[model samples]
Target: MSELFENYLACWNETDPTARRALIERHWSEDATYVDPLADVRGHEALDATIGAVQAQFPGFVFTPAGPVDAHHRQARFTWGLGPAGAEPLIVGFDVVVTGTDGRIETVLGFLDRGPG
Candidate 1:
């Protein structure tokens, strides 16, 4: 479960499109959907583009796990923090993910716990 979150954050932190795409392919299902307060997207392409947009918006920010992940029955929820390295997080979020039988992410429902507003 921690590995899943680690890979998910790695996808967000990776600037190279090729590396990020590989992470997405390995961690997420082909038809995965992600919905948050600000964006809703489906499939690998949209997910990749959305992640790139976030990286562009906050050039040096990195996403990291903020708390322990709790998972059961192919579903998991975790908290995350986003900010410059070694600084307090500027954004905090919670996400619930559902995994397919094959153990890849199938859907992600996200919420903003805190933001830069």
Candidate 2:
């Protein structure tokens, strides 16, 4: 489960479109959906684009796990922090992920725990 969350954060950190898309394809279901306070999107293309947008908006920042992942029965929850290397996080979030029967992410429900005003 931790590896899954690590891959999830890696997807957010990857800037190369090809690499990111590959990560998404390997870890996420084709019809996966993601919803958060600011965005709601479904499918691989939209997910890729959304991640790209975040990368563009916060260039050089990286996403890291804030704590251990807790998972049970194909569901997992974790917290994440985003910021420049060696600096305190500027944005923090929590996400709950549901994996499909194939063990790929089927859906993600996200919440912003801390963000710029």
Candidate 3:
């Protein structure tokens, strides 16, 4: 699970579009469903659009994991960040649930802790 998470972060950090897309193709299942704060996408095609949308909104983003990386029941949770250094991360302690078997991610659900002021 840690390996997968590590690979995910690495792929995300990669600047090249081809490389990132390849990583996504390799790790994500064909029918994978990706759920985030704003979008719920299914399949690689949809996932591609979802990624584009996210990148459009948060360019040069990365996930800053906080605490342990647990993959029990095919799910994992960690923190994520957007923007450059010294900027307060838009989200903290974000939860990501990846649904799949044998480490092949079939679905991902993300949750952000952003409460009212």
Candidate 4:
């Protein structure tokens, strides 16, 4: 289900509303909640706005997986890097995601590891 996690990152980078929603439907549970240092939101629509806000704040940047996804027992933890395309990351963070029985994300807890200093 690591590929499912990859598509979650893609949802962050996606600018098209329709495609983003579709990805959410495929990857996240209907009641999923996302919590980070900046915000906490529940459900797909809220996740979409949170992601859209991040994308807007970092216009032209892309989010990339920082390393291999380490997953087991329906849960996964991974790091992600965000920055201008092809450049070193300006922001890096880790997130732990848990999936529901249906194989879709149920919760995401995020941490801010590094950023402009």
Candidate 5:
């Protein structure tokens, strides 16, 4: 796994909004695309908005990794906290992010898995 992949996951696990936004800004390109259940966003502003919406909706949400990261493809599967700790995490999705040559994410395809939980 590349350092970026690990760092990206670490950033995803971050709860602080400011820190999380900073991480996204640092790792993703200005023209990055974020595809989630809510919407497909292009550019930093949209990305910020998507994160903001999720933050607003989830409240105490936190993403917990559920499987091995496929760093070669810049992909990962993770479960997320819908409310607080100890509650069953919702298996949000497997995210496949493609990075540009500059090591910034160019696009992300999020596939939601609602199975079993």
Candidate 6:
């Protein structure tokens, strides 16, 4: 669960579109969906595009796990922070992930705790 959530943050920081897509392929189930305040997306292509857009918008920022993850019954939640490496976060959010029966991510529900100016 920890590794998977870390990959979620990695997806946020990955600047290479191909690499990010690969990450999505590796970690997400085919029927996966992601939703937050700003957007709702489904499938690998949409998830990849969403991650790419975020990287483009926050050029130098890296997303990192902000706290310990809690998981049970195929569901897990964790907080993440976004900023330059080693610096204070300008953005923060919590995400709840639901793993499929096969243990791949089936859904991600994100809640923004903070956002950059």
Q: lDDT tens digits, residues 24-76, model 3?
A: 78888888887777788888777666666666666766555555776677787
RMSD of 1: 0.8
Give candidate 1 regions above 4 Å deviation.
none
Report the Cα lDDT for candidate 5: 0.68
- Clash list (residue pairs), candidate 2: none
Worst 10 residues of 6 by lDDT: 4-13
Query: TM-scores of all models?
Result: 0.97, 0.97, 0.77, 0.95, 0.76, 0.95
Q: Between candidates 4 and 6, which one is better according to lDDT? A: 4
Q: What tens digits encode model 4's per-residue C-alpha lDDT throughout 10-102? A: 888898888998998888998899999999999999998888888888899998989889999989999999998999999999999999888
In model 2, the worst 10-residue window by lDDT is 2-11
After superposition, which runs of candidate 6 have C-alpha atoms over 4 Å from their true positions? Answer: none
Tens-place lDDT per residue, model 2, 18-68, is: 999999999999999999998899999999999999999999999988988
Decoy 3 TM-score against native:
0.77
Candidate 3 whole-model C-alpha lDDT, 0 to 1? 0.67
In order, the Cα lDDT scores of the candidates are 0.93, 0.94, 0.67, 0.89, 0.68, 0.89
RMSD of 5: 3.1
TM-score between model 2 and native: 0.97
The candidates, ranked best first by lDDT, are 2, 1, 4, 6, 5, 3
Model 4: lDDT equals 0.89
Worst 10 residues of 5 by lDDT: 74-83
Cα deviation at 34, candidate 2, in Å, is 0.3
Candidate 4 clash total?
Answer: 0
Residue 35 miss distance in model 3 (angstroms): 1.3
| C-alpha RMSD of each candidate structure in angstroms | 0.8, 0.8, 2.8, 1.0, 3.1, 1.0
Clashing pairs in 6: none
The positional error of residue 5 in candidate 1, measured at the CA in angstroms, is 0.9
